[model samples]
Target chain A: MKQVVVHPERCVGCMQCQVACAVAHSEAKQLVPAQFESPRPRPRIHVGAGPYNEGFPNRCRHCDPAPCLLACLPGAITRVAETATVMINVDTCINCASCAMACPFGVIRYHEDRSAQAGKTVAVKCDNCLARQREDGIPACVEACLSAALTFETLDAAYKRQTDAVARSVSAVAAAEALAPGWALLNAHKKARLELLTSPAPSDEKRAAGNAREDTHVRHD
Target chain B: MQYVIIGNGIAGVNAAEAIRRMDPNGRIVMIGDEAFPPYCRPMISMVLEGSVPLAKLPIRQASFYDDCKIEPILGNRVTELDVDAGRVDVNGKHVAYDKLLIASGADPRPIRAEGLELGNIVYMRTEAHVRRMLDALDGGARRALVLGGGLVGFKAAYGLMCRGLAVTMLIRSGYPLSMQVDAFAGGMILDTLTAHGLDVRVDIAAEVFEGKDTVEAARLSDGSRLDCDLVVIGKGVLPALDFVPRDRIEVDLGLVVDPFLQTSAPNVFAAGDAAESIDVARQARWVNAIWPEAAAQGKVAGINMAGRTVPYERSLSRNVIRIFDLDVMTAGVVDPQVITGAEVITRFDPATRHYRQLVFQEDRLVGMTLVNAIEQGGVLMALIQNRIPVAGRRERLLAPGFNYRALA
Candidate 1:
């Protein structure tokens, strides 16, 4: 399943993606009419400015072991098995905010809309534009990215691109070494790069080992 | 290999699932005292409040046991555990096991007062208790008196109030939820309860019950008698370890288990409220009776029982509850007296009923309490669990826009 992946380096902080998300979620599905619609539509994504004028768009990652689904007392939240998209049933939700508190990303919002069940507030979060995906095969946020910062792709494709970028950087350095007139040094560097590229990627066991080391100071009873 | 599990609560069910994942063909037998299938115990209050139907209580469908190939023996109590013989006596039948797990859970503490054995007194622990309370309400029992100001007591009081019954709560502590929250948060809870027409009296106790056959009134420690038709005892619960022999296993407030959830007896394990494991924050062996910890411990125990070695990490104390429109959450060691060199930061707005307090030991966050605005609860718990150093970020910890991902 493909998801909208945000690239912080290319984000220009225009918030057009957010606006498009709100419009896509609205009853009218249009920008001008959605502003005056009853119970104003809320954008599922948020763009925040960071240090040194860097901006990033933050939304739900749709975690595999989603905490929001676990924390929901009434069992209103569910995950689509085929797409792995986390969603909430608004009609069954009691608006208790347990999911809001459980979400680590702070993307879930508790919003009050008069048009929804006579002014009852409910938790709202990104559903990855489920309706649009079924129709257009892409999320509204990724479709609206002006700088092409967001890409809708599968996990395998994303990781492959990242590895390819790393390989390109290593090859570029090797070519630069070859131009410096040191054949032996360049060959040694090429051999090392080949071994690095051929070796299997890091696994969760390595991550767990690092975690155990970091937790040495913790007093275990 | 055959695995025998006692109790059908969340912990036991989770253990069964974990065991099935590892050893697919193991003969599994589960015994539970309750007649019904496993349900979410924490939602008992919601069940009492009539917000949720009883049909939706089961955590899994009836086909789950069949799919998992588990033989369930419900509505039967285990009478004895013969550890030496590798069997448990249930209703005069000896059930043998290669490995045994005790997840019997806990039972509500009985109210000990004169005339306490009256007919109308209800102890909220199981589904039967909730049914009896609902029946009493149906039979036109109007007024109720709840003893204890803790979580169970308040939930019972609130449930009774929702059922159109006049409720009067008496607490022995200075405020409600003394063990979980600070005085400020407790005071706000008291205010909320009082505003909602609940007669919440703190720093008081019910000394005696006056009645002919059923409870008609309760005499207070302050020498005052209040008329009541029903008495609901929500004083909390104690670990149910009476079925185990004292000489066979080590027992503290609960059954003592090691980091691997193994008891003194060979091939025997315990989890849930019945097992006393390590408390990470206090560095002590104690029964932290909460749902999340119990489920995690059950998983760890099940994995180990299936020939895989896994250590059960100690869990910090945590709770999230909503009382009549107010949201409150607590995590880690909230008591000021527990930690040495503790620094406290607090923000309270009585008008909006929003309160936030963070407790720090040196530079690490040890505890936190949030009311109304609690989106930071998961982040706070992660910080406490990871022992993140918050040296100069104390203010950021309390900030409304605190980003938890930044810590990574």
Candidate 2:
């Protein structure tokens, strides 16, 4: 059972996964055709700019004891036992954002979907690309990700690999393993630049005035 | 073990299911006032508004009791509960129990007025009441008069409005859902309802019903007579704990339950609308009678009843409502005046019509009211629930694009 794993540090917020996601869920299933499709397909995954302007990929964890499932008023949300995917029945969904309030990760979105009843809007979310998976394909988001930020692998395999890397990093005799050295360096540079620009004292009043709303807004593209 | 559970609501049903998972051989006898299978209680409002059919209310299948191997005593209310003797009297029969759960839920608080037995006047609490309202609608109900500023009354008024009826809501507060949300957020909700042509009368209530066999009009408290065909009272609900012996079992606003969801009496427990436990945000005794709380409490109660000492966590007061174009989510102590040292921050983006009002007691997020953009509400709610320190992160939460990463 391979599932999508998130590696936030490697993400550059290019939004290629968002484009690929919309195309994958669209009627024509292509980038150019998806734009012209009625009730345009939307991405289920979101990329949030972290506090220090680092890219952070956000999506549903498909929790075993999902809060959204329990808090659902119409009982529209359910879990697929095989894939461990939380699926929403759009027909039964009342367009009530109860699931959004229950979802701690803030993954679920409400919009008019093409697969749903014509013009009726409903709660839409990630289905783990079950249709694509059935055809022996990976999730659209993972396939579109160029930075290896999102990968498809078994949870145990991912955990074991991470554990081995962490153990080796702590060993005194062995050289530490930096998983994505280039990405790590890039993120550290961005964070340091952000810290320096915003931490100006009273003497730097001109810089402070320009950077007042610098940390206020960060678009989740 | 003979397990006697009261009420077939979500709480009782979840408790029964939990106990079945642990004790397969226990003789579970569930006594419920509602004869129908366990249905989502909150969806009764949807049923009222004609969005969801009455048939679609059941949360469980027809073979629920059979599958769980539990004996069900339906269409009966608990007449008396003898905690000392470990017995329950429902429909003139003493059903014994080794471990008892009082998940009897709550009933709509009755209002005092003339013509109390009027035919068309109803409380939108039970499925049967909604059925009665539907029948009235089918019988050519035109004008509706709703009382109360609470969720029930507000929902009833909204439901009637959705059905293309002329609705006049009489609220005894500054705005609707006053208890659930703050004044500013309440005003936003009130605006949406009004924009949809819902006639709202603030600080007003119905004094008397004037009609022959069915309600035709209501005499207002402000000395005004209004024409109405149906009357729905949503003045809120009281705990259905009349049967409990207060002398033996401690009772507050609801039945007082311990951390393990057990009552003061041994071998007895209470959950759902009837259980009063410590409130996480308020940090005091409070009854969060919502469905999700009931489900969580019942699971814990059943687990503890099955011989595992699983302590139930402090309950949070929360509600999320999607009314018209507005989505409102509120939790905990929303009223700032109630808390002496509480600091309140409100940010309204008029362009998008999104609002965020957060109440804080020192570094902890005590309560929150969100309008429109509320996808990340659960994150803020978790912060409040866990009593996490939000020293410099308060402004970040008020931002419209706030998400889980914002907290990090």
lDDT of 1 by residue, B95-116 (tens): 9999999999999987668888
The candidate that wins on DockQ is 2
lDDT of 2 at B261: 95
lDDT digits (tens) for residues B319-392 of candidate 2: 98988888899988899888768988777777678788889998889999999888778878878877888855
Report residue A32 deviation for candidate 1 (angstroms). Answer: 3.1
Q: In model 2, where do residues sit more than 4 Å from their true spots?
A: A172-175, A201-221
Considering summed lDDT, which 10 consecutive residues are worst modelled in model 1 chain B? B399-408
DockQ of the two-chain complex in candidate 1: 0.12
True contacts kept of 2: 0.48
Candidate 2: residue pairs that collide = none
